[model samples]
Target: MTAQGLLGAGVQLVLVVAGAPLLVGLMRQVRARLEGRAGAGVGQPWRDVRKLFGKDPVTPRGTSEVFRAAPLVTVATTVAVVAVVPFVSTSTVPEPGADLFVVVALLTAGAVATALAGLDTGTAFGGMGASRAITILALVEPTLLVAVLALSVRVGSTDIADIVSATLADPARVTSPAGVLAAAGLALAIVAETGRLPVDNPSTHLELTMVHEAMVLEYAGPDLALVELASAMRLTVFLGLWSTLFLPWGVATGTGVAELALGAVLIVVKIAVLGAALAAAEVFVAKLRLFRVPELLAGSFLLTVLAVVAALVPA
Candidate 1:
């Protein structure tokens, strides 16, 4: 790998690992203020994670190794994606893992591991959460794939870096009808995938409505910390990917120190702004009924389909 690629990868790894929780905290703080309640500062998530790590781990009896391993697997997969995806710079390390399909597969593997762990718990809540999570995943993965594919069609490459670089070269592509539709579809897919509002609420602990938190009810201490950290990282990664794909104005095209530094700052700003906007929007909306969730996702899928058609057919 070239020095620039290595530097880009290193920057992404450090930024995602350190900034993910802060992003979560910022979103929470924004929501809290909008609702007229004092909120914990942005550093609260960092404190919570640190406290969880210091606590003793717990493993319930009758649970298999899958239960113990799921958090590790999830974190590992996310870390792998951060390493390969061109989040901070397009001049990233040359690797086959940068392929869109491979990145998608890695994300899916993490979800599957978490689902299996939920089943392994043998608890009713765990099973219920696992089933719900899988159902959402079933709908989400296709939309995500097709949405990105719509963008790829124009560039004729499934490599995320190539798509970003192409978009950079042809700035007009971002304003096309296909681009608008794909962005809408991709944003919705990310919301569902990250267990955000209307599809699933990250802050909810209510048994009937909780999808992700339900699966992790059995986890405590360090295991819980890993799971929480991974969840935050996934949200950040998706947001970062979204910004890199659509609003790629500031992403580094070369390995120059100045370019990389600016890219890092801009990405962090983009994600934070997006996170705040999402939180603000959530304040005005309520979670949908379970059955209605599919309808919402299906609509997003349709948008992606239209995006593909729009991309393929000449204007």
Candidate 2:
């Protein structure tokens, strides 16, 4: 990597760390507006993080070392994911294998670590949350994998870089019926994976309705901050992946300075629009009954499978 490339990568790291909170803040602000309530400022999440960092952590009695290490592992995985995911542009940054499958796997690793930590706490809520989270993961993962397969089949490579390049090269791929179906499926998956509404509400603290929040209720101090920040990073990675794969209109294909700048701007705009849409969704839709959650995920799976079949059709 040239100096500029290295600098761009460093910029991505900082943004993932800082911008993740901003994304969460924006979502909350928009959701509040949709509900006709004055939302918390976009800085609220940052404030929460700062507070968590300053407070001293109190470990639950009998908690193992696993409980202590889980938060760090989770954050590290998410940070690494931000590096691999082509957020600003497909042409920028370094990727291993460029495979969409690899990106999905890395995300799964982060989720698994957090879920295990949840179980490690030995609290009733934590175990309950972990079980529910695993159920959702089981339902969502296959659909994501299948969707990637569908996209790979169309573009003739599982590599995301090639996939983006193919879409950019043709541009007409955007209009393909199969592509549209996959986009819809992927959008739903993003909501589910990120613990967004109609799946699980990220903002809720009610134990009965909580999934992700329930898992981390016992965490305190810097450990809590790491988990919270990891959640934010997870959200950003999914949004960034979506931007690169489906709406990569402007991204650096090489190390060109101007192209990288344009790519960065485009990424910001896309995520802003997406965050607003997510906020609007949360305002209008209630969380699905926990039992009904499977149905929703199953619907996404069927749609993705249909998309794959649709791609096989001559267009």
Candidate 3:
């Protein structure tokens, strides 16, 4: 790879790492504002991470190596996924076969690690959370894949970079009805994937309602910080991917410095808008009950399948 390419990739990684916390904080702030309360500063997440990192590690007696190892896997997967994502237009970081499908697989790998770690603790809440997480993931993965396939059909490849490049080459494709449908499907998938409202609430600690939080109830210290940072990174990566694909108006299409700079600015703006929308969603919607999750995911699946068919088949 060229030195410039490597530099660009590093820039993307650094950007995601540095911006993840801010994005999380923004979401919290927006949600608070929507609720007619004084919002915490956008730096709140950074402070929380700092405090968590300085605390001592706590391991439950029933926990195994998997619990110790999960934070590492979670953080690593977030970094890896961010690198693989086509942030500045269609450019990918140096990695072998890290296409869209591979991206999904890596994400699933992370989820599996988390679920296993949750169950390893042998706590009732942990076991319950893991089981629910598994079911949600099982339903969400197909919806995600089908939503991605909707875009892939028009672009004729499942590689994320190729899809972005194709979309850039013909901007009008964004206005296509199939494109609109795909965007809707992907948006729903994003909410479901990220554990947002009507899916899972990040701010909730109630054991009866928590899905992701219940699994992490035992984590503390730097390990908890890593998990929190990883979750933030995951949110950023997914939102970035959505913007890169659907609203890539200012993204770079060629290996040029000016184009890259513009792409960077546009990406920032897109993410900011998306973050606000997510926060707004969280504010207005309540978390679904445990049993309601399956129906929600199933509806997403049907919408995604329809989107794919709309893209590939003749009207």
- The Cα RMSD of model 2 versus the native structure comes to 1.3
Query: Each model's C-alpha lDDT?
Result: 0.92, 0.84, 0.81
How do the residues 1-315 of candidate 1 rate in per-residue lDDT, one tens digit apiece? 788779889999999999999999999999999999899999999999999999999998899999999999999999999998888888874766388878888999999999999999999999999999999999999998898789989799999889988999999888999999999999999999999898888887999899999999999999999999999999999898888889999988889999989989999999999999999999998999999999999999999999999999987
| lDDT agreement of model 1 with the native | 0.92
Best by TM-score: 1
Q: Candidate 1 — which pairs collide?
A: none
Q: Root-mean-square deviation of each candidate, in angstroms?
A: 0.9, 1.3, 1.6
Q: Which of the two candidates, 2 or 3, achieves a greater TM-score against the reference?
A: 2
Q: Name the Cα RMSD for model 1.
A: 0.9
Give one digit per residue, the lDDT tens place, for model 3 in 52-156: 999999999977899999989987887887776768745544645247888888887888788888999999989988988888889889988888788888777
Measured with C-alpha atoms, the lDDT of residue 27 in candidate 3 is: 84
Clashes of each: 0, 2, 0
For candidate 1, what is the TM-score? Answer: 0.98
Please estimate how well model 2 matches the true structure, expressed as its whole-model Cα lDDT.
0.84
